[model samples]
Target: MLTEVKNQIKVVFLSIKYSVMRELLNRFTFISNVIFMMLNNASMIIQWLVLFSLRENMGGYTFKEVLLLWGIASSTFGFSRFFFYKAFSLSSIINEGKLDSYIVQPKNILISIITSDISVSALGDLLYGYIMLVFYGLSIKSFLLFTYFIITGGIIIAAISVILNSLSFWFGNTDVIAETGNHLMTNFATYPDGIFKGIAKALLFTLIPVGISNYIPVHVIVNFDLNLFLINTTVCIFLIYFAFITFYTGLKRYSSSNLMSSKI
Candidate 1:
């Protein structure tokens, strides 16, 4: 059992290493992509600043708290995209029968698919998150907690994408649905949870899950609530298991194209 776990870890690291090396082949483009994304993320802070100047707080979130919210959201998104980018494109991959190469590999199909590519722009988001953390006042405890939440949040995000994209196996063409779901998750994650009410709140907590992914993490960072932390952890675990189950189950229904294409 221990050996199996170690082997999986090695596979994951090797996959990421190759993906990063491939993206870095064009060093100038990679650097520009990262910088542009960082600037784009940083630009949103100005709007938040303008809004906060007029009001004391927006939905119980002070300007600093909003910074933390962005930090967590961006970090989660960046990690998911950088390490598991294929999660976002799984539907298109499926629709085009691009699962051929992955199916022939001995590694876990989901991990292989996700780590097949890396998003250079997402490195900016990862850096932005740390910058925000510094602005929000860095402490050893807060930094450690933030790292923990980022991992859980990124896993949940990837799991959600997998679950949504896996629908293509049954629904034929679900690229649109998967894209919409991904957009909604990203949109909702950037805002404060206090702004949501009733059904919206419930939906965020359950269906879309930006609540636990972003909101609860913010709350945990701010106040360190044990219950919310545990709930977030539990939900993350469940989502990961659900993603794996859904993907493999759908794989049984996958129709592969026999096109001869080399994997990078």
Candidate 2:
């Protein structure tokens, strides 16, 4: 069992390593993408800055906390794109019957598929996150806590993507559902939670889950809370486990392109 786990880890690293090398073949483009993404994310801070000028706090967060909120959101997004970008394409792969190659491999199919691609621009988002953390206030405890949330948050994002896209296995072409899920995760994560009300807040904590992925983490980062931390951790575990189970379960019903016939 341990050996299989180690082998999967090795495969994941190798997949990412090769992907990085391939993208680096065009060094200029890769660097430009990263820099542009960072600049883009930095420009977004202007809106918050303008708002904070008008009032002391926006959505119960001071300017500093708001910066950290964006940082956590960006880092989570960066990590997911850099490490598991392919997870978002699960719908296309399933619908087009491209998952057959992965199924015949010895590695964990989901991990193998998800880790096979990288997003160069996401590197900027990851680095910019730490830059924002510096602005938030650098500290031994703060750094460690921030890193913890980035990882767990990234996993939550990827797991959610997998869960959404895996639905394609059962529901035929579920491209629209998966796309909406992706947008919801990215869009809602960047905002302070207090602004959401009623159904929006409820959805963040439940169906949408930006609460666990970003809001709760930002709160814990500003002021550590054991209960909230544990809750986020538990949800991360459940999402990841459910994602894998759902994908494999649905896989049993998958129809390969090789099995397709010309109707003519």
Candidate 3:
């Protein structure tokens, strides 16, 4: 047990180190990211202002919860963009005959494709989200929950991205699908899932899992439920594995069409 624990710690540390390296590498990319970051930050503030203007609270949540949700959403958005930007454009990568290049590489094609197009501008979302989280009275327990929230959100986002990308294996072009799916996930992440009802809420929890990002967990935090937390955590873990399996299954279908057409 001790050995397993130590190994897990090492793995976590390595993951963190690798992520930091990727972020550092992103610093030297194009200047356009600065403008994007600025706009994203401004948008967060504007969203809060707009929400507060109508009423101090929407649903059962206050302006503070709204702000916190925005922060978490933006941060998750940025994190996804930074780490998996390539996943967002997998359809194009497959359609443009660029996936063949990845196939020739020694490393894992999916990881390489994903890491190749990191978006630093999303970090702006992360920064602003964290700041908003702090300003809205964050406690230690909340902080722990927030970490779990972000990690789970990343997993679900990755799973959804892979599922969307897998479409490229069979379909010629899936840009519209990818874009629409991304938009919905972003929308779900930004608002409390409780605001959604009936089929909408059901879809968010099952098909999207965006509700797990903030809604269910936030509710658990507010109401203090250990069972809910455990269930959600387990679900996130399951989703992560589910995503990997989907990607690998899609990989089996990825063939080198002619000399150029392929998804690596």
**Best of the candidates, lDDT:** 2
Candidate 2: misplaced stretches above 4 Å?
Answer: 259-264
What lDDT would candidate 3 get against the real structure?
0.70
- Candidate 1 clashing pairs, residues 3+ apart or interchain: none
Model 2, TM vs. native: 0.96
lDDT string for model 3 (133-237, tens) is: 787778898787776777677666766776787687778688788788888888777776656899988888787777776676667656778877877788778
Best by TM-score: 1
Collision pairs in model 3? 71-129
59-80 per-residue lDDT for model 2 (tens digits)? 8999999999999999999999
Can you tell me which runs of candidate 1 are displaced by over 4 Å? none
Residue 18 local lDDT, model 2: 90
For each candidate, what is the lDDT?
0.90, 0.91, 0.70
- Deviation of model 1 at 98, angstroms: 2.5
Q: Give the C-alpha miss distance for residue 264 in model 2, angstroms.
A: 32
